[model samples]
Structure formats: structure tokens, C-alpha cells
Target: MTLLEVSDLRAGYGDLQILNGIDLSVNDGEYVTIIGPNGAGKSTLMDSIFGLTDHKGGTVSYDGEDITGLDTEECIRRGMNYVPQDDSIFPTLSVMENLKMGAYTESELSDEKLQDIYSRFPILEERTAQVAETMSGGQRQMLAIGRALISEPDLLILDEPSSGLAPHLVDELFDKIDEINADGTAILIVEQNAEEILNRADRGYLLTEGKMQREEGAEAMLADEEIRQEFLAG
Candidate 1:
């Protein structure tokens, strides 16, 4: 049951090639992470999938259909959502209001769904009306994630959810991620926190120099000394 399948994806801005024939796949309800060094095209991969970049060549299959270059709105309509690493939320809007924006296309706004999100992130319900600008880094991350969840996407592409947060906050964030996965939405994550993300993931791909070098189970790969020294310490 493959929800998302990317084969030989080549994309870039203008003439600058970022993702070089990248191939990846995510099964239903799988927690997959792509760990890579900066400038290794992690962000570019997400951008290409969400149709935010110029994709020169590739096949992006979502739920058995090709969505190689669908616009953002179209992709969202296809049950695919993206939460980038930065500037994903409206700074001036209240948290609850931001969520309302996420549900703009939905005809029915259910408390049951909102309560489900709030249960996973208690902090969000506590600060539901607070302006997004005033939230802490960790809280902001939580809000960004919550906003995306409002769509109840079948697949959520998160680019570095653990960026710029304290150590403890990362753990809490991953716990929430696990909760989301438990509810049956597949997750595709790109995180710079090698040890942290890999430990929590079900599978991981090591992308470097714009190429995937290795693929393995999250915990098993985390225990590999060479991988730790290369990506974690580098």
C-alpha cells in the first residue's frame, strides 16, 4: 500500500539542479524520515512534491495517480499537505483562527476532529486564542503541525519539525508525531537532527550531495557508529 511514490525526481530553480533523480516511497501509516546534511536537497525534495519548485523530470505518484506538478491547492485537495521548516503559520492570527484557515475548504467543521488534535497537543488547546507571533519556538512548531492536521491529510510532508527547539521539546514533538501516525496518517519527515529523528522513525534514508546513500530501519541505522559520526557529528 504505497501512498506516495517518487521515482527519479529531478527538480530545481531555473537552471540550478537541487534534487538529482531522487527516488523514494512511503507506505500507508509509515513514519519515514530523510536525514541529510544542509544543501543536500532535503528542502528541495519537499518543495518539488508540493509543486512549489520547477520540476524538470520525475514521476510523483500519490494514491496510484501521477501528481508530478500539481499546484499547492490541488495537492492539498488530493489529501497531501506540506508544513515547511519556516514561516508556515500566520504570525498575527490567533492559534484557533489559524486552524480555521486550515479548514477553509471543508464544509463541516467538527469538534470531534478539533478535540482529537487538541488531545495530541494539549498546549494548543491551552493557547487556542493566543496570537501565533507571541508563541515560543516550540509552541510555534506545535501550532504549525496542528494547523496541518486540521486538513486531516492522508500524507503530511514535514520539513525539519525539530528545527530550532530545545532538546526536551524535540522529544515532546516526536511523541506528538507518533500520536498522529497512530491515527493512520502517513508521515514523510526531513530532519537535521540525525540521532533524534532516526531513533523515532520506522525507516530512514540518508540523502547527501543530493543523492540517497543508504536506507535502513530507524533504530538499527541509528546504532550504526559510522552513520552517527558522518551525519550527526558532521
Candidate 2:
């Protein structure tokens, strides 16, 4: 079943349009990745779904409910979480504090959820009292992802989770993402590292100039000579 559905989405910031008549969906526990060249509006599609953009048209439905035009908080209340490419964590806050803040909307944080997050990212457990600002880039990303998972969202939307990380750390980060999806949270990621994401995703979409140019299974896209030559830099 489709957990999140976006149809003919058209959105932008203020008067400038970014996505044009785009359609996308994520089924329960599915791993979906969107990849394209710079300025292809990959992030804009995520922003639209999360209600961070000026939605000009289209319907966004989550878990069989229409969420079009809903505010960010309402989207979160409905079991959706977003981790942007940059500035996702509170710099001055300690690791534990950042995770605690993630559950602020709820009545209280449960120990079970906290323990789950720590298990998924063991480094976070060791650095619970460390300041977020002092951590390495990869550690900060892990904390951001861990904080988002504290809510136990049904769908976790990530924009460029691998961006700006050292090459070796990128694989480690993807491993964490794979573990998260294995535990049954659907993932929708917009990534610049196309080949790595395509290798791991169940499905992949290629966007160009604000529109979806192709949609296919990850392996098929990887094997297509045309796609590899044009987009994957074969």
C-alpha cells in the first residue's frame, strides 16, 4: 500500500516555481531515492511533501489522508519526519538534548525509543553528553537521523544524507540508513551520490529540470547503458 502519495505536485518558494507537475509515492517500508543534476529541484519535491514550500497545486496524501497544505507540525503529527541536507541538528545542544527535543511535541520521551536510537547508532550512545557542535560531520549527521527516529515516524524523508561527508563515512552512513529501513520505516531520500543510492534503493527516480525523467527499479537503472552514460557518468 502506498504510505505517501504526491500527484501532479507544483510548488516553489514565493513567486519562483521549482517542481512542475511531478508525481511520486512511497509504499510502507519501501526505500525510494531521487537523483539528478544540480538545480534539478530534488529537494523541492521533498519540501513540498513536508509542507515547507509554497504549494501552488497538487495533492499530497499520507496514509490515506489528504495532507495537502498542512503545516510542518501537522505533517509531523501525522507520522512524517524530514531531515534536511544541512543544519538539521541544534549546534549548541548536547546529543541527548537534541534527541529529547525531537520528542518535544509528544507528552514525553519513552526509554524504549531512546534505547532503540542508541542501538542503531552506537556512537551516539557514547557521545550522549557531547555537544553537537563539536562532533565530526558524519557524527552530526548520525545524530540528526537518530533524533528523527526518536519519533518513530512511518515515513522518514532525507535530503542528501551523504552530502559533505568523507568518502569512507558515506558508506557507513548508508549502512545506518539501510538498518533503519530494515526495521520498517519507509525511506524517501534525495541524494547527490546517485550510484551509491541507486545500488541500495528498491526504486529510483531521475529528475531533470524540476520533472521526473525516469522511474525504474534500482538494478535496472544501474544496468541501463543509456542511463549510466548520461547520468551515472559511465
Candidate 3:
């Protein structure tokens, strides 16, 4: 089942077009990554789907319904959650408080659900009362992810999740993401860590200059000589 679909998507900030007829999709429980260099409009594509950009043209379908220009709140009601690269957590809030906010839309906040998130990131459990801003960068990222997971979203959209983490922490972050996908949540990520993310994703798309340049199985993209040299090579 196709969980999310974007067709001929053209979006950007007001009066400045960034994405040009982009097409992408994430099926139920699939792990999909978009890799591109800086200024390729990868992040714009994500914002467009999440309804944070100016929608010039295109159809964004979620769960078989058209959500082309739906607001972020409505998108969340439809079981889609987005964690932007910056300011993803409330700096002044405690770890538990941030997570509780994630479940604000729920009719009944389930303890079991909270437990699952804590289990996924034990550090969050340990620092439930710790102020979000006081934690290390990696721990803050974990808190952000744990908060997003509280709602049990069908699709979790992440932008550059490993951006500022230490090299060792990058692997740990990816491992947690893998665990999330394994537990049946679909992921749509735009990552700068090309080799790292593409190596783990089930499928990947190469976006360049606001357009999709290639789509292939994750391992295949890594193996392609052209892709390796042009995008993955040192």
C-alpha cells in the first residue's frame, strides 16, 4: 500500500521556486531516503509534502486521499509526523513534557505508547525530568525522535537527523532509525549523509537541482559506478 505519494510537486518559499516537478512515494512500512548535495532542494521537497512550503502545483496523496495543500495540523491528524532539522524539541521543556506534547492530539494518551518510546531510547527514560536544552546534542536528537514516536505515526518524516552528531553517534542514530522502521513505521528522510543513509534505506532517490535524477534499490545505488563517483566518492 502506498502510504504517501507526491506527483509533479513544485514548491518553495514565496516567490522563490525550489522544487521542480518532484515525484516520490513511500509505501507502507518502507524505508525511503532522498540524497542530494546542498541546495538541491531535498529539504524543500519534504516541507512541501508536509505543507510547510508554497504549493505551486502537484498532488500529495496520503493514504489514498488528496492532501495537496493540507496544513501541518491536519497532516498530523492523518498520522503523519515531521521532525525538522532544527528546533524539533521545546528547549525549555523536560524530556517527558516534550513527549507529552507529541501526544496532545491523541484522544487518550496511552502509557503503553509512552513506554515504547522510552524503551526505544533508554536515555530518554533516564532523563525524563531533564531539561531538553541541557542534554548533549546526540541525547537531544534522541529526545526529539522519542517525542515523535509517542504518537505512533504512520509515517515519520525526518530531515538530516544525523547532521551535527559525532561520527560514532551517527551509527547509533541510524541504528535507532532502523529499529523504528523494523517495528513497522514508514520513514521518509532527507539526509546529507549520503553513503550512510543510502546504505541502510530499502530504496533511495537521488535528487539534483530540484529534480529526481535516479531511483534504485539502496545497495544498487551504492554499487553504481556513476553514482559512487558523482555523489558517494571521497
- TM-score for candidate 1, residues paired by index: 0.95
Candidates, ranked, TM-score? 2, 3, 1
Which residue pairs collide, candidate 3?
none
By the TM-score metric, which is better: model 1 or model 2? 2
Window of ten residues with lowest summed lDDT in model 2: 101-110
Summarize candidate 2's per-residue lDDT along 1-234 as a digit string, tens digits. 999999999999999999999989899999999988899999889989988899999899999999998998888899989999886999999999999999977988799999999889999999999999999999999999999988889999999998889999999999999988998999999988888899999999989999998999999999999888888889
Report the lDDT tens digits of candidate 3 across residue range 41-147. 98888889989999999899999999998998899999899988966899999988898988888775588988888889999989999999999889998988888
Q: Whose TM-score is greatest here?
A: 2
Against the unseen true structure, what C-alpha lDDT does each candidate score? 0.88, 0.93, 0.91
Best by lDDT: 2
Using all chains and alpha carbons, the TM-scores for the candidates as numbered come to 0.95, 0.98, 0.97
Pairwise TM-score winner, candidates 2 and 3 = 2
How does candidate 1 score on lDDT? Answer: 0.88
Estimate candidate 2's alpha-carbon lDDT, on a 0 to 1 scale.
Answer: 0.93
Q: Per-residue lDDT tens digits of candidate 1, residues 107-131? A: 7658987897788888989998999
Reference-based lDDT, residue 161, model 1? 87
What is the Cα root-mean-square deviation between model 1 and the actual structure?
Answer: 1.5
